[model samples]
Target: MLRHVVLFTWSDDADEERREQTLAALRRLPEEVGGMTSFAVGPDAGLREGNAHTALVADFPDVEAWRRYADDPVHLQIIADHVKPILAARSAVQYEV
Candidate 1:
């Protein structure tokens, strides 16, 4: 399997509306994109300093499937139109599992 992990830190000035919009986009991803075998996304609990504001873990059957997900138009659109506007920083990793 391929495991993809993403960490996102929202801008300090991000408001509730922007956060909700981000969530809305994420909620649509599974249905809109293909090749996602498992997915989990949520805001951080803030149990530690220097943690990102949100995290996503998605598993795919293989690297090709993961790539399909990465290149999905809906995912790209949401990242560009909604997520990027309020993002302070982002990090990600993709690896075989």
Candidate 2:
């Protein structure tokens, strides 16, 4: 299995509405897009310096699955329609286990 990890930091002005929208979009991906074996998203309790405010943990069969997810039209729409507005910064890391 492979883990696709994503972290996001929101600006001070980004409010609950944005979070909710982001969550809704996030929650929809596994059902709407193919190739995602698993998915999770939530706030970070770690609070490490520069640690992302929100995190997504996804498990896919392989890197190709990851690419499918990354390129899915619905996913792309979420990035353009919602995430891009409220997202201050984001980071992603992928690895196999």
lDDT of 1 by residue, 1-97 (tens): 9999999999989997788789778868888885888998888887999899888899999989898899988899989988999999999999988
Q: Considering only N, C-alpha and C atoms within 3 Å, which residue pairs clash in candidate 2?
A: none
Top TM-score: which candidate number? 1
What is the lDDT of every predicted structure here? 0.89, 0.85
| Predicted candidate 2 versus true structure: per-residue lDDT over 1-97, tens digit per residue | 8899998888779888878888788778888886877788887787577677888999999998899889989899988887888988989899997
Runs in model 1 deviating more than 4 A are none
Query: Candidate 1: worst 10 consecutive residues by lDDT?
Result: 26-35
Give the number of the best model, judged by lDDT. 1
Error of 1 at 85 (Å): 0.7
Clashes of 2: 0
Taking all chains together, the TM-score of candidate 2 against the true structure is: 0.87
